[model samples]
Target: MNCPCCSGKSYEECCKPFHTKTKFPQTAEELMRSRFSAFAIPNGEYLMDTTFPAKRKLHNKKDLQEWGEMNDWTKLEIIKTSGKNLVEFKAHYNDENGTTQIHHEISLFEKLNNRWYYVSGKFLD
Candidate 1:
């Protein structure tokens, strides 16, 4: 699929490594980019895989598929990220109605076994 970051690259070359069992993102910014790619491809498995086990919600493929089908992501942008293993970002995307929405969040991630997993997020407005 096209790179969700709109960097004119394939998802594999852009952000798949962070989602797959390949490489773990070294920074929060990289993780944020990979998450955007996940939304673009509607890869719920990848999303869940990247999510911290403590924060993972739906474990069933059917539910994941349903969630994936419910949204149409258009764009993503990170406002700022700081601290160790914790990042704050803002993502903008168009919904099914073509309405643009902004999700500002402070995300937490933990590195385990040399892999970073999304722990949780606090939505800010």
Candidate 2:
């Protein structure tokens, strides 16, 4: 199947390695893409695992899983990357009501022990 991150590659060739922990994302953008795929796959465990350790308290696997299960993730659009730790992207999905929605955000990532972790995100209009 095509990658949910819309990387123009199969899931196995794209985000699967990252999702499966066989390989970690090398950059913030790659992490962002994999994170989006995680949501599409509704892999709450992966989502929580990739989050910055200190920030994990602000989120939970159950909520992440429920959010993913409630939505139909469609596409991911990368807007830009600034330096090695920031990524701006849009995630398109349909809500539980079947309303199309786009989540635009500039996300901050941190590299710990050479592995990128999602730190936080600032939502945008």
Candidate 3:
């Protein structure tokens, strides 16, 4: 299947490796893309797993999973990036009520031990 991240690559060659934990995203943008794929796949565990450890408390795995399942993830647009630790993107999806929505954010990432983790995001208009 084509990657939900719109990477123009097969899912296995694109985000599957990251989702399966066989490899980790090397940059914030890669992480962001993989996270979008995760939501499409509705893998809440992977979502929580990729979150920065320090900030994991603010998220609930079940909630993340349910949210993913509740939406139809359609596209991911990477607006910009700042070096390797930040990315601005828009995620388009349809909610449970069939309402189209776009989530725009500038996300911050942290790297430790050669792996990148999602730190946080500031929502945008």
Model number with the top TM-score: 2
Each prediction's Cα RMSD? 2.5, 0.5, 0.7
lDDT of each: 0.72, 0.96, 0.94
User: In candidate 3, where is summed lDDT lowest over 10 consecutive residues?
Assistant: 111-120
* Per-residue C-alpha lDDT of model 1 across residues 81-106, encoded as one tens digit per residue: 77767777766767667787887888
Best by lDDT: 2
Candidate 3 RMSD computed on C-alpha atoms after optimal superposition onto the true structure: 0.7
lDDT per residue, candidate 2, 1-125, as tens digits? 99999999999999999988999999999999999999999899999999999999999999998898999999999999999899999999999999999999999999999999999999999
Candidates sorted by TM-score, best first: 2, 3, 1
Instruction: Itemize residue pairs with steric clashes in candidate 2.
Output: none
What is the C-alpha lDDT profile of model 3 across 5-123, one tens digit per residue?
99999999999999999999988888999999999998999999999999999999999999999999999999999977989999999999999999999999999788888999999
- Model 1 root mean square deviation, Cα atoms: 2.5
TM-score of each: 0.80, 0.99, 0.98
